[model samples]
Target: MDIDLNTLRASIDAEVNRREFERLPARDDDSLPAAGLIDSVAAFEPIDLEGYLPEPPEEHQHIEPELVAELLPEGRFYNWLKRPPFARHLQRPRIYSLLTRASRLPGGARLSNFIYIMARGIAYRIPALARLLEQSKQWRYLPGRLAGFEYQANQGLYAHALAVQRNERYLLDRLQRLEQRLREQQAQAARTAGAPAAEAASPPAAMPADLYVDFEAHFRGSREEIRQRLAANIPRFKAVAALFSEPVLDLGCGRGEWLQLLQESGIAAVGVDSNPSMVQCCLDAGLQASVGDGLAYLQGLPDHSLAGLTAFHVIEHVPLDVLVRLIDEARRVVRPGGIVLFETPNPENLIVGACNFYTDPTHRNPLPPALVAFLLEARGFIRVEIERRHPADPKLLLQGQDDGLVQPLNRLLFGPQDYAAIGHAP
Candidate 1:
């Protein structure tokens, strides 16, 4: 459908004219550029009010709330309300502003960025919500529609606003954990430095010569699920894996899935798994597979030997103390400017703790994105990005594989609920 530019223009003119009539500004009003009016109109034009479909029915809306937030007057919702159409730009920022200001100061840039990111999801969903608005057969009150939109928008806007404002507490708590972990790693490194060369030469934990048996036990019959997950991870893994331009290590590479994807993408890859049967299976597939402890395995390698390393869903299994050791060892082996891509199940996901969290008996706890980002930043990583993924339903998690794809079905019946954090070494 196409946007009814005329309707938009008429609405703007009516609103602007009404505002001017109520409180006519002097010559200053005439001097103001007409660009603001046009821009605002354009912002609202993209979203097809299906019930009020302009003409075009794009899958997504044109007015991005983030852009709207940036355009809104002085970033203050209160001021916009006193104005005309600007007051209804999006209800989220206003609610967030009120809640955040009242509780405490928000986390400067990070907090704002975080809220905007979540708000973007709400904006994307607006088209669907707008569709519902249009189809509300009995709902004929324009004022009621406007109010409903405003209330729904506000709900989306402030869904996580309070958390971002309160993120500072988590930040401080994470920093302390990092500092303490570093001290322990430093002490361990010192002791290892003094060990006899031969003692240090002992081989890292060995993988079983045959891994197929173990692969069968852990992965079992989920071949298609493995393929889908690997495909999803390939591009991300490649983003960092390609940097090394050399054979890289995939620590805790589950079932050698990622390694296979990397190899197909033409990056040389070796996988190390702690599960003996998994190592054997991968090796039988003609891949270089080893069963080993991740940290000890990294330490035994020559310093700066690796171009990159990947540890997906690996660190969560290690205790907090061992986590630093793993990162430290990764730093030592990877060349300067090398990349490390770490991903784990997001704790914020509804089923993560309740269902998927128990899939692996070894999983200690859900890894919150904020906590992961904090740990990496303290460890001297430069760029950090946190992402959330949709968790597979219990059918997929428990049955190893489901003939019916449960993730999409659950998202249809439910919604998304997974998270991840990515960071780079300085």
Candidate 2:
């Protein structure tokens, strides 16, 4: 690169200005010096305007690397002083710390202050340590500067949120009014056009068989696998099954696993589901099955008629208020001393609730085990028990450790993924 005479002069002036800044007297409160004042001229190393200066070759291009290293110069006096024996060490961290302490003391105070500033500037290069250093500087004003938002901004945000809510309500009200008006117009046209015309135009109320079956296939396991799992748990069902004179009623019986298990155990049972294909599959397998909404079926049954009522992984598909009503109906429809069992995905298992439970789009929300138990008791059902089911892998669970930490960790990581709320109707 070429060096211009004007640029060379400017660079020389900047070096002199930098030296003047270093000689400036220190302030009382430890503020920075006026070093930034020379920044304009500091941009030039040498005045290379005409490309007169040569650029160095790339690092690894030379065969004799040591010769290339020798080209860089170090002052003779400094090199002799920095050598071994007479030169043990020129600097250490402790020396800087002692210098900082001396800055607060009586004599040599100004020199110590300059050393302290230089040491801290070097320390700020490491990001992790630098953040802690920065926090120390901001300690007094942290509360006022939290998230850097002002009081005015918070108030404005609150007002904007309220306005958005009001606009949403207004739009909903207008939509409902428009729907009602459209319905009225349709009804008026039906009166003039005839009942047959209205019937022809009406849409189907039930979900298509192929679509419903496909949805079940996407979210559910095979019927054979479910039956095998249910068969393994037949001992638990038998205890409840033996207490009743009439057959059990299994509502929302997806693939008839419980129904098949009840038959194999010689316990009479009937199943009901909203899906026609599911009900047909159950009937084809010679199980007594019916197509109907679970809630409506429970309502239609005579009071205290069924021996036991069991619905697995079904309650979470309905609204909370509807679930509460279903519990009340279960207590009513079940005979005295009969079992009412409702199982659902447990919200207590962090993984089940936060992740796996949502794999099925039909699931509304996970039901807390305690909440279901409390609901059963509130609805005049006694001897209620919360039975956690389907625990995750044992290796994942923190176990066999005497420490208190492992127990909570075990409950969070390997606790039951699903739970059953069992109660006896009085």
Candidate 3:
């Protein structure tokens, strides 16, 4: 058989337009012709309309009614109508019979055959009432077909909503890709235009600044929780404060919890962080803080300017070279007999080392307490010690275990979640 592509294309286009038009609400002025009205009335009878009515468009034919119910404006109302008293009344065979018969009548006759069948089946027990209903004239004009119309309307709305949602997602994805491409182009242009050779070399992937701040806020606990945790370190810092005259400095002072604790203890303190929002939070609380790279801020300070230096949960986020330089700067700035503390997630805890350490995308790698202590000693700090804090909950440990293997197993599974390396400036 010869194929006519133009005719097939025209037919498909017409069908698409027809379906789109059917999705629209009926106008008040539109009137059905006598013959069409008769056909419509017959279509609403107890007999199946599925064969008589046009099949739904391919895209909408498989849509589940339950999935689309919430997207419809009258969804709640429809759900309410399906419950108890209203549903019981609709289920009466007398009412359903009347609707089924009237739907076949002329002039304003509209009713759902599917609903009639459903109601008839439910009310089949009351044969006498059904017989009485067959003669009733009062319900002949009832607009029971509105239920069928509502179902069809809901399906159309759901299909339209799904299409719109897909379109929006596609546009958003495209916009993000465009933005990424634009940034890459700008970086390349800068590299070609007299930028430093080192900077032009392969740079590390950086998370968006705002996103990182929000990520930290979500994962790093509330300010009150952090303050409570840092309270344990107060005596340690207080001892160093008594020996030195200069103020303490906290690098990456997220929310300035340590700074606040030190100030409350009558020890002067200052803080520096790269996140502007965190610095703003500190400033709002009447704490002294500035927005800058922690190591860069340390480098700017004169030798023996600070009494103590602390960085809590900050080292894991930086490169090894940056961490070494930060330690070197801490030693140069902190006074003799003053302390330099570096707190980090303890990789000794098997769970923390293998899984939890990667929760923060910014974390470079887990650093062991012994490695930090060695680094501090190598940088000329004396009396280097490791303070294991925030141990795993006692309930997680193996109970009633006297065996040697059990103790070691418990330690491996439920050990200190974090640790701090404290080294004195010599």
Candidate 4:
């Protein structure tokens, strides 16, 4: 070949410039380096020409020559058989329409249900076959689509299990606390047993020994008369009779009239009194009775030990502090929804408050109905109410007077001779 002198001279100059450019250091710009370029041109070594060639697109890339040679031809017939007919996208709509129409026919729903159950049973029985069937839908990526649904279901189950465990733990903790409190109360009672009788009889301390001596003989009425007066309260207790499944405690149970009445009504009752004579009378009448201070007896019992507590004409004998402690102990010892009833001379009635109240030397002071009711509420009792009882005879009222003062005078002179403060434990 013939060479042009001018072109040859230009090519020699370009070759000299290219070698100089290759020897220069790389630029410090953010742009990436060319493929196969080393950190520095000074350390670069020439690679094989084949290694520097551009790679073919992945879609058009060929397999290994030996592997391609071993692969047998996948004929039209084999491909057709390999693909599942039900899974074909083109036929799915037609198959679904046919199934809907068949299901509309009589008994078709039952037949379809039976088939679905059988299919599930077969899948469970042949897990390997089930896995193979699932693999056929790999193109649709069923597992990936169902992943979120499965995660949500598992979360719900976990939350429910956690809630149940927490509730069980809470209930167990409450039970343990109650048991501990009961043990503490028992220990306290044992300690108090060896103490002085005066300490134990805290409430009755307001009453002098002279008052307790022959007090029942001088003040207590006949059993028949007391029973007649107490009979009116039987119906009041009947409504909540079922709540007294456990024994009811009657504090200051004088003469055992209330105990006898409870026995007639088929309710189990126990009596506590500071007076040994009154307790003996209860025992002699086949009633369970104990000679102990009402407040101390209540303190000795465990939480929720009693179903009901009743003290008739007893609270008036105790001081305010003693009455408060008595009510507090009653609240602790009584069960939830249990009854607490206190009957005392009504201070609302002028005759009772000024005259009849002091007839009993043991009475500390007459408690107003409002004060008693308020105390019950303050101590966490519910449904507190004051029920006035033993109204004065109508004949005792000033007759033939249309004046408003007449009614007021009668109320102040007579009104209700006694009142009861009734409450229920929360």
- Using Cα atoms with residue i matched to residue i, what is each candidate's TM-score against the true structure? 0.46, 0.48, 0.51, 0.53
User: Root-mean-square deviation of each candidate, in angstroms?
Assistant: 31.4, 28.4, 28.6, 19.8
Cα error of candidate 2 at position 368, Å: 0.7
Q: Provide the lDDT at 267 for model 2.
A: 90
Clashes (backbone N, CA, C under 3 Å), per candidate, total 20, 6, 0, 0
Off by over 4 Å in 3: 1-205, 400-402
Answer with 1 or 2, whichever has the higher TM-score: 2
Cα lDDT of model 1 by residue, 325-351, tens digit: 666666667676767777677656556
Runs with alpha carbons beyond 4 Å of true place in candidate 4: 1-220
In model 4, which residue pairs have backbone atoms overlapping below 3 Å?
none
Model 2 alpha-carbon miss at residue 191, Å: 29
- Quote the lDDT for 238 in model 3: 88
lDDT of 3 at 355: 90
Which tens-of-lDDT digit does each residue in 58-106 have in candidate 4? Answer: 4344434333213312334223422565234213333333333444445
Clashing pairs in 2: 1-51, 1-52, 1-53, 2-51, 2-52, 3-47
Global CA lDDT of candidate 3, please? 0.72
lDDT of 2 by residue, 191-226 (tens): 456533111000122457557667666655677766
Which model, 1 or 4, shows the larger lDDT? 4
Q: How well does candidate 1 match the true structure in TM-score terms?
A: 0.46
- State the weakest 10-residue window (summed lDDT) of model 3: 196-205
Off by over 4 Å in 2: 1-219, 395-407
Clashing pairs for predicted structure model 3, backbone only: none
